[model samples]
Target: MNEPSTIEKGGAEFEGVKLLLCENPLPPIDETIEAASDELPRSNHYTEPYSAPLRDLLGDRIGVSTEHIHINAGSELIRFA
Candidate 1:
């Protein structure tokens, strides 16, 4: 797992800006495998369940349009336009 502190710092001349912090701990490998067992048959077409709510919250904040948000179940990559 990567550390939160590893997030790339912005420019040197810092301006006051709001920062949101989030931390998610992954389950053990065995647990993850067990949990995903049910989805193995359909994993190829899987998508993350929480993506919509998260996109709704993000809105256009990060240049991401809600309509372009796509999340994959087996991957951490989140694509947006």
Candidate 2:
């Protein structure tokens, strides 16, 4: 069953908040937004299918086959396979 709905609080949240209490300093919001804006044009195309290269890099670091790797599309998609 779901942990009693924190939907009552409203807005975007990381599911990891349930598991990890972090106090790490986040980067400046304006710099982050500017960096994202630099990649805005690429959003016009379907790029999810293009993530294999990233998975390959991750697999190399972890010493696993790329075919065995998976990347969640977003925090909302995080779950056991």
lDDT (0 to 1) per candidate: 0.62, 0.69
Residue by residue across 19-69, what tens digits does model 2's lDDT show?
336554565699889988998988786546437888989999999998788
* Model 2 residue-pair collision total: 0
* Candidate 2 lDDT: 0.69
Give the runs in model 2 whose Cα sits over 4 Å from its true position: 1-28, 48-50, 60-65, 72-81
lDDT tens digits, residue span 19-67, model 1:
5665345446887888789768887865556478778767767777887
- Give the top-scoring candidate (lDDT): 2
Question: What lDDT score goes with residue 36 in model 2?
Answer: 89
